[model samples]
Target: MNQNLVIALAQVNPTVGDIDGNLARARAVRAEAAAAGADLVVGGELLVAGYPPEDLVLKPAFIDRVEAAVEAFARETADGGPAFLLGAPWQMRGRLFNAALLLDGGRIAAVTRKYDLPNYGVFDEKRVFAAGPLPEPIPFRDARLGVLICEDMWTAAATAALAERGADLLLVLNGSPFEFDKPDVRLDLARARAAESGRPLAYVNLVGGQDELVFDGDSFVIDASGAVMARLESWDERMAVTRWRARDGVWVCEPAAVAARPVGEEAIFAALVTGLRDYVDKNGFPGIVLGMSGGIDSALSAAVAVDALGADRVRLVAMPSPYTSRASVEDAAETARLLGAKLESVSIEPAMQAFGHMLAGLFAGRPADETEENIQARARAVTLMALSNKFGHMLLTTGNKSEMSVGYATLYGDMCGGYSVLKDVYKTTVFALARWRNRERPAGALGPGGRVIPERVITKPPSAELKPNQTDQDTLPPYDELDAILRGLVEDERSIAEMTAGGFDETTVRRVWRMLHRAEYKRRQAPPGVKITHRAFGRDRRYPLTNRFTDLA
Candidate 1:
């Protein structure tokens, strides 16, 4: 028997529910792999129907169409150049399954269904697909290959079963979403699995943006000794080929070119860019327009938009009120100029005055307070919305997670937009991203390089500028302290007592917790944004608006 194999990993992006388009992409990639003399071509999980088809899989008609497409793809392999392993939904015995098919010789040779279904934190696979039975390795050209779909590899049982069944190599397909530090976590898991099974492993992950989730395709190959042999680039689309040969009675993969992975803040920034770009282009938006206040949040949002869509497609509007400082105006203009985007100045003084005059009679005895400040914000929102309507540009809201955690943002005002670019980002990280953009521009960015965000914007005290000498600190805790408390409550779900014992002030923690619970109503109405953390506000954490149960313990 031949002891050599060539496998091509197709790291292509697929739009959800675009069956025809997805199949075309698959055919194109399979042709490329065949030309390269690969023995087999493998794709990501759910490649035919796209990952997370969600409730779409419940429709029998959709599954029929997907099966038809898979058959058509299988027929094309009759030319005998390369075999294909493609992902699709299968219906058998009135049960739906997430399945991978082996296509060779103008027909499907075998099928493997997913054994494990993930149910927590942006995953509801169990809700849509029935759990498949334990799988056996399939016979290939010269070896027995074991297939593990995504979550199946996270546990040791599946690998052990495949190894016990005499599988020679393990191939894992994934639709894994990108999170901070996820690459390290994935590598560690692969190493452990390889060590346990005593076989080489190949992993291919889906790449692209799907609503709030961004899949960073860091596909890799590892030797049985638990060393990385090849790694594909993240945040981009490409096909990586790995060659294997049997030596000393053990199959080993040859070392190939490995792409470096982005880490920390850089990985976070890349995710943001990919998420925004796909949302705009896939949704068919003409361009994007955002309110460019001189503060760091808006500055960072504008930079991300320009980088994702280019300076020409990004429009910046600075709506200054009576309390808007000259320094703010200068900073906004300077930032726009540096990024090579046009800044449109729209003063909201007249609109604010008109609203105040209209409400003067109703506020005869009430003292002027946050109500008046909200009027200024609402007026700016109206101006921005008008531009969005007239120009057909998608409005991008710039509120960060810190403000969203507390009841700090005005509803129907700054929160009014088609999308929230910084909805999942913390205020502290916002400042850091602004500085990072100035230092280094990311790859595939369309904007001009060097100091995209002005320095003063990063150093200045953050403010809504609704009143004289107003700063965020007047109404909220310092960002560092506030963010720490927020992570404890929102991400970690820690109790008030726990946070206090961890060196946080009791009174401050209680106050922030109260604000966090009170703002659930606002967050419910906020626009969708990219999720970078493991526990983002939207799909990850769900809480009732009327709940009075406080974590005083």
Candidate 2:
């Protein structure tokens, strides 16, 4: 029995349904860990088949392939240098379970199933996987290692049970998705469990984007005292190593390199970048093309695109309509110049005229209203979509969450795109992020640093510019008030009266509430975007399109 154990956290990103590729990554990382003198290596949750295989796990053939890959991984350990603990879905007695496989000495040593199945907020594990009985510690070399899946570690009972069973250390495998401030929340949970169990805990999280969910791998290790011993980088992939030693009859992880995690808008910005990069790259898009409205939203979106896919890969089109101000056109060009993205000018006036002439007789008696405005937006959408098709570039929509919240955007118009980078970002937060990116270029940003977003764009009023003297505030409340009300209604799920009592106007709150409800259908059809906040439109917060229920009081 070795008194000292070295563990490596193989924080690799796995694509959903990529069994062979994921197994190759696991094997390669294991070889790296073995070279580093690690006694054992552990990967993130469901590493072999990727996290949230969704309905793919329901197929028997997929499960068989995953199990075969796990066996192949086990065979690689025959060199006897380091053991591997990885995750995969297994079927036992005709029941599917999310199990962790322990491979040592070239064979599968033991298997432990996930006890807690999370069924809320982007997770439907209960539907796909059967919850196993409480997991006990598994023997590895000379140490009894307690293994817990993602959701199991959130509660104390699992870790406490392992401690009572005389587990030497706790290892948690996670497919945790990135949300604002989630890293802190995860560390707090881990610290609480470590304190209760009086044992060192190592948390390894998956890193990469899967559909709308982006897994920020902020893998970490904490000693018995709840002090963070080692921390891995977030929003990127890295393999981290932690050394553990038994001291005074207690196993404690020694101090190691701790990477500083991004906080607030920094983390959110990184999430948007990672999510967009993975969504575009993984889906095999040649590059991205987006309409640069010269407004804060599009400016920020272009900046993010440039940062994610590089300036050469991002194409900026300034589609000015009859109402499009000269200032906006100039601003859009300047923004493209600043970001070094290729800017093309396309006038939507011809399309607008074409649509107006086509609808003139039908709309002859009716006063020109939002219908006319939507035509302009739709024209822009058509031009962008044409370019997207011709050049094989993914059209990036630029609507922020505030507009998406209140049905403020035009369907099949501004909302037409393969992805929306700022779909989950509020208008106020968009300004904040624009300011942040101007001042600091965070790690992994490929764009040029220093004032990339013009200050005028941030200070200018927001508008759809659909009509004369048009601004977002004319149809909706001011962004500050609107975002506050939205946070309460959407994220906090507060009643209208609750929001009004909290210093918001009753009329404004009710109006916002109505708009939010009316927008459900639009959101259902909108393209998937990166989720930065606690509650995003698609998965995190789901609302019925036909619901007549209102919380307005």
Candidate 3:
């Protein structure tokens, strides 16, 4: 009788520098898979010290810690009921290579180093890892399996090399970050690579939001005919075991379908909400607190917080000033009530007047300008932070991506938060998600009745309420137009000429670029947000902290 194999793809979300913790994670997954009679399990890149550990690999002690933990893992699997294949940074001959190691029978079975180090966009793998030679697949039971780390599978050479070395099955471990429509793109790539390798492939990815970037697991398997046989859920933790049959002396795969991931606003909403909840929970925060401004951004943030934690765990402050309109105050109040949160109003007028009188002498020569406007924002910030300090609640800053990109926000004023909830979400998206969230309530929504965000807030022109009769359009272009230009330039990497060619007013295009470039320093200091795109401001979009690059096209 031909031998059959059942393999488990463990999509593990590992934390960096927590070697013991990571190893424990590996063991737990391994034990689960072994209990299900699985022959092997695959984990993602840098499963030991975590992906993008960056310079942590430079420390000899860190590497030693990883090695020690790996040895301990090997010891725990001494009887070797299930083989483990996972990525880790390995050092030999005083050099580091991005490696995939196979552990079985209390020892290292084989280690394959990554040959391709991506150096584009957000990746700087070449700087950290030395390229290594092509590796042959490890033969076990009835299948010859080749292991490739993240970057190697992106290129055809590694697959070709493995095929030339007589690999019958290909397994990949990935730490791929989430972007709009990336799941389909990844599935297509996996299919092509599997057909090219002339073998079935199993792909496992790490899950969870890290800083600005979120890794959506959604690990999958593709058959020899390049048809996807199994799929996993995105942005969530899941485990599944697939059976492989030995048919006519060749390995064949059968898999289970992963529940489809949420799409568009729903997907982005879940990512942002989960990002906030996990960041707060993992960082040891008691609760989340934010100021409700009757603005779409804060309203969405409040909804997310209430959805993430219970409504009881989310609190709101309404520290309105003279510039804040009556309608806005009422809207904020109603929104808070809908979200089942007890809203507090701390009038910042006294503080504002006090500060205004104090700054009278210092501003004697200056005209009344944005300084006064910023004073209102600063007053609100101080009030919120004071509440946070008194109650030990983590302040969740509410500023959408458009404002964050253009220095429209006050630095210490609105940016005062333990974490920024929507830093990666653009203004247009904020509007859409606010409407969408109101339409479709999350399972744990705190609101008792109708949509929390009022139709007035959605339809009304956005305003900072920093000054009388002020609106966002007064300082910035309409959100639709601005987002069009931004999507072209930032996401599509279109240049000034490209934006101009795409029917944008040349002057407006150049001015927007200027705003984006000038505001890099501000974004650098802003709290991290959920990364729903391929290139979030923090990890993906990097610029010189000090640079003066302006496009005049």
Candidate 4:
């Protein structure tokens, strides 16, 4: 009789630095997989200490806890349930390596170190753990498992080495973050590895948010022919076991049902909800508070908050100034009513008047300019911060990527928040997301099913409402054009000549380029948000605050 195996893919949401809590979650998942009669259960990268443990790995005490917890978890294999393959930061021979440990028969059977440390984009593993040598297959019951960590599966070298050494199945553990177009990319890489190695492959990814990054748990399994057999859901925790049988001296995963996953705007909204939810919950914040200005960005941010943390957990504040329109005030009220969230109005007029009177002497000869406009913004910031401080809710900033990109947002005013949901989303995408959320209720969303955001808010022209008859286009270009130009400069890293050559106005392109660079310092101080794009503002994209180089065409 040929050998057969049951492998379970466990996608879990782990909080960084919560060693004991993470292990408890893993144990619970293992128990569920065992009940399904699985022979081996595999989890995502760094399941013990959490992925990208970052500088947490620098502390010897943190490493000690991880090693001790791992040893203790290995001993639990004596229960005769499914053996566990988990990832953690391992310190061996006085050097730490991001490692995958195979636990069977009550001891640490084998350890596979991550040879490829991703150092680009949001990854900085090269600064932390030392890269290990190419890994070999580990022998398990009835099969030799080729284990590849997150970055290891991106290239063919690791898969080739494992296949040459007579490995039967390729298993990958990933902490891959969610980019708009990343799900297809991950699947392609999996198919490429399977076709090249001529072996079936299984992938498991960590789900949930870690700071600004959110991982979509669309873990999947592909056969030797590079066809996907089983697919998991995204933006949530899931566990599925696949049956495998030995055929023609190779292992093949039995075909399982593929779950439908969210894509495009739906996927981005899910990422935002997941990121915001985890950030607030993981940080132990009781709720979220934000200035709901009746603008699309704040309306969408409020909707996400209600969807993520529930209406009872979200508090909306309307900080109206003299410049705030009646439509805006009404829209803000209607938005809160639709979402069933708590709302309070605090006019910034008193603060504005006070500041005006205080600064009238110094501004005796100076005409009113953006300086006065900025005072209104700062007043709103103070009002929101006061509420957040008094009531235990974390402040959520609502500025989108477009305003943030062109330096249209105030530094300490609108940017003052503990976190942001639209920090990485551009203005045009923000409009699209708002429209989508109104029509569709995302999977696992807690808010109402229909139209949490007001229709007027979606169609109205965007503005800061600090001055009369002022609109966003009054200071900047239209969002569609602005986003297109910014995408080339920020996401594609195109030069000024490249942007202008692509049918963009040269002056507009150069002006947008200057704004992008000038806003680096502002972004540095901006709250962390969901990273839906390939080039997010924070850890994903880095730039000097003071730079002289401008790619003038």
Q: For each candidate, what is the lDDT?
A: 0.90, 0.90, 0.83, 0.92
Model 2 poorest ten-residue lDDT run:
544-553
List TM-score per model, in order: 0.98, 0.98, 0.94, 0.99
Q: How do the residues 1-553 of candidate 4 rate in per-residue lDDT, one tens digit apiece? A: 5879999999999989999999999999999999999999999999899876899999999999999999999999988999999899999899999999999889999999999999999999999999999989999987899999999999988999999998999999999999999999999999999999999999999999999999999999999888889999888899999999996667888899799989889999999999999999999999999898988888999999999999999999998888899999999999999999988999889999999999999999989999999888998888888888998899999998998998999989999999989989999999999999999998888899998999999999998888999999987988899999999999999898888889999888888888889888988899888898889998878898878886763
Clashes of each: 0, 0, 0, 0
Give candidate 1's whole-model lDDT.
0.90
Model 3 misplaced regions, further than 4 Å: 442-450, 545-548
Off by over 4 Å in 2: none
Considering TM-score, which of the candidate structures 1 and 3 is the better prediction for this target? 1
Model 3 scores a C-alpha lDDT of: 0.83
Predicted structure with the largest lDDT when compared to the true one: 4
Per-residue lDDT tens digits of candidate 3, residues 275-351? 77767776778888999998888888988888887788888988888888998998899888888888988999999
Task: Name the weakest run of 10 consecutive residues (lDDT summed) in model 3.
Answer: 441-450
Put down candidate 2 lDDT per residue, 1-553, tens digits, no spaces: 3378899998998988989988888878988898899999989999988888999999989998887877877887888778988899988898999999899888899889999899888889989999998888998766899999999989987888899998989999999999897888999999999889888899999999888888999999998888989999888778877888875657888899999998888988999999899999988998999998989999999999999999999989999988888889889999999999899999998888888899899888899888989988999999999999999999999998999999999999999999998999999899999999999997979999888988889998888899989888888888998998999998898887788789989988889889999999999999999887778998788888789776753
Backbone clashes in model 4, listed as residue pairs: none
In lDDT terms, how accurate is model 4? 0.92
